[model samples]
Target: MSEYHVPVLLGPSIDGLDIRPEGIYVDATFGGGGHAKEIAQRLDDKGHLFVFDQDEDAEANLWGATNVTLITSNFRHLTRWMKYYDVIGRVDGILADLGVSSHQFDDPSRGFSYRYDEPLDMRMNRQQLLSAADVINQYDAVQLQDIFRSTEK
Candidate 1:
């Protein structure tokens, strides 16, 4: 019944973390907290889970998770924030689920999928200025082609 994105390869993904009961962990992309919940459940009172998510919608799902400390920022600055929180070197494991969530692709307004003819805004972080529309409209054909080609690898 939960509308949240169900994390792919849930068991194997978390297993790869090699979770320790009293260790500190980081869920770099806490979309729907699917993996975070599993990580939290395995941890005892001495353990901690730091969740980083740029999406504000994810904040609602984190409520009541006593062991979790939600950081509302992009994971690209993960090391910076970890240092700010003073958990830098103490971290036991870090898990990052990259790529757009199913929730983003399913929502027509988010403008990710070709299935829906919506605006060309494809920013996962809604606060960002550069959108898909901006790239297409602002960039020259050569620049755009070069950008696309780089991602092929």
Candidate 2:
């Protein structure tokens, strides 16, 4: 595992998959490729692995020699990417390790964790324009109210 992010609950999480040697799998959030590496290990030469991650930094940790397809997009659009890649319903298993990675939480510049008093820029994809700063400083009263109200229930 890369120092960028150490995958939590590594063994139990991967073991729970009950991986098949020739089955197709998806790692929805391939942070640091720790879990992905394990999944790849269990796969035979005919097996395939598809990894999805919105954050760009995570790409640096992916292995090039594996039969893994890395998609640079959020898992919310899993169906779209699956169809685009022709995987669709062919996937035998999926492993999603969600939430902020250690690299994002530990780094103050990412502005994800409250431990650091950095810029209020909490965007998973940096390409997006709406940030935490924009919500706090630019959103209208009605917009802010709607946001707060949604969390109340």
Candidate 3:
């Protein structure tokens, strides 16, 4: 477990994966690499794990694992990238921990925790143009309500 962000349900989640030592897998949300590290350990040289995270901060937690490939991009584009890597149809398992990590919540600079006063920037990817401040300031009442109501893309 990383001090940066501890993984939730570590044992059961890996058991649920039913990972094959030689199988290919995907870690869709590699926050602090807690899950990714576990997945990588379960794989052999023949096996591979493609890990994805939109936040550049995730790169800091990457351990030197030979069987893992870290892709610094959103998992929403999984198909396109998987096709590019020629593992589109061969993936055996995928693990996605969608909850915000401890690191993100604890970092006052990220503006996620209310314990400390900071800028209202809650962007997962700092490179993105739109931000929490922009949305709150620019969006109208109806627009904000619509966003709050719908979870679908």
Model 1 residue 133 CA deviation in Å: 0.7
Q: Which structure among the candidates has the greatest TM-score?
A: 3
RMSD in angstroms, all models? 1.7, 1.8, 1.4
* The 10-residue segment with the lowest total lDDT in model 2: 57-66
> What tens-digit string does per-residue lDDT give for candidate 1 at 94-131?
99998888788888998999999899888888888899
Give the Å shift of residue 115 in candidate 2. 3.4
* Candidate 3 Cα misplacement greater than 4 A, ranges: none
Off by over 4 Å in 1: 149-153
What Cα-based lDDT does every candidate model obtain?
A: 0.89, 0.90, 0.90
Please report the TM-score between candidate 3 and the true structure: 0.95
Give the Cα-based TM-score of candidate 2 against the true structure. 0.90
> Pairs clashing in candidate 1?
none
Q: How many clashes in each structure?
A: 0, 0, 0
Candidate 2 local Cα displacement, residue 107, angstroms: 2.2
Model 2: how far residue 136 lies from native, Å: 1.4
User: For model 2, how does the per-residue alpha-carbon lDDT over 1-153 read when each residue is reduced to its tens digit?
Assistant: 589889889999999999999999999999899999999999999899999999988899877846898889999899998899887989999999978899888889899988998998888888898889989999999999999999899
TM-score of each: 0.91, 0.90, 0.95
Better of 1 and 3 by TM-score: 3
